[model samples]
Target: MSVDRSYIRVKAMLVSPNDDGSRHLVSRNAPTSENPLGFHRLIGGSVELGETHQEAIIREVHEELGARILDLTHLGMVESIFRYNGELGHEIVALYSGRLEPAPADEGGTLTESDGSVVPVVWRPFDDADITVPLYPAGARNWIRSSLT
Candidate 1:
């Protein structure tokens, strides 16, 4: 199905922490015209028409990483308005906190997208360097910090 880029999209995302909660799982995003350096984002995807945000998160995690989420909790919501690949995109993201079952390797790994493209997944410290590629949706880091605390 072709997405209507002109309309705001709704997504459900999961912020899954490691065993010690020192780092979280994120997938590396490819460099777009708006982000030449690329970035990292939480795991999850769009909420299907009949599915709840919670259901969407679980389904997305399973699809992307072949894992299940435990202790799922609604964190908060974030509105993301940004440009990607030269196109302006808007989204209302529902953020959820949880743990991944059979957690990803400590050293990091890769996730295969629905489109058949593979992207690296890594455990990144919360306070990574400011100069490094940023986490998308701007205030996502803040929500993650609050959920962990």
Candidate 2:
């Protein structure tokens, strides 16, 4: 079994407006069949050898959420070690918090769920993040908390 010695990853904040000063988070579900790392909550993926972290995040946001990223700012890096179904990998995930362009309407781009099925974009109240269905990565919560402040 070959393993990737090193890899870079990115995650988008995907923020929307709320009546209050706080913002809502646009999240999705990871396709359980295709992705085991719970990657659905944020729009991101691995950065290729020649691709920059920002490029990858922007590309993924368009691909997954079907919305253009107006702004993407780095939220520092988090050391993530993931073990899925016996496969182990480590990532230097560059977390980012950004606002979506066009102010996500009721309908958004096609995003895959944990079962490898497509799910529509969802607007989640930041305060009620915990009760939402489908689990998210620890780094995502951390970034949101820090970014909002």
Query: Which predicted model would earn the best TM-score?
Result: 1
lDDT of 1 by residue, 1-149 (tens): 24568989999988888999888888888797877889888888899899998889988999989999889999889999987777788999999989999899987588877777888998878766654887876778789766684
Query: Residue 9 CA error for candidate 1 (Å)?
Result: 0.7
The residue ranges of model 1 lying beyond 4 angstroms of the native Cα positions read: 1-4, 129-131
Model 2's alpha-carbon lDDT is 0.57
TM-scores for the candidates? 0.92, 0.64
In candidate 2, what residue range of length 10 has the lowest lDDT sum?
10-19
- Candidate lDDT scores, in order, read 0.85, 0.57
lDDT of 1 at 19: 92
Q: For model 2, how does the per-residue alpha-carbon lDDT over 47-140 read when each residue is reduced to its tens digit?
A: 6677877787777667665667655677777666665445555666667767766555654645643345566566665665565354355556
Error of 1 at 100 (Å): 0.4
Model 2: C-alpha RMSD to truth? Answer: 5.1
Task: Please identify model 2 stretches exceeding 4 Å from their true place.
Answer: 1-23, 30-40, 85-89, 107-109, 112-117, 129-135
Instruction: Give every collision pair in model 2.
Output: 30-113, 30-114, 31-113, 31-114, 32-114, 32-115
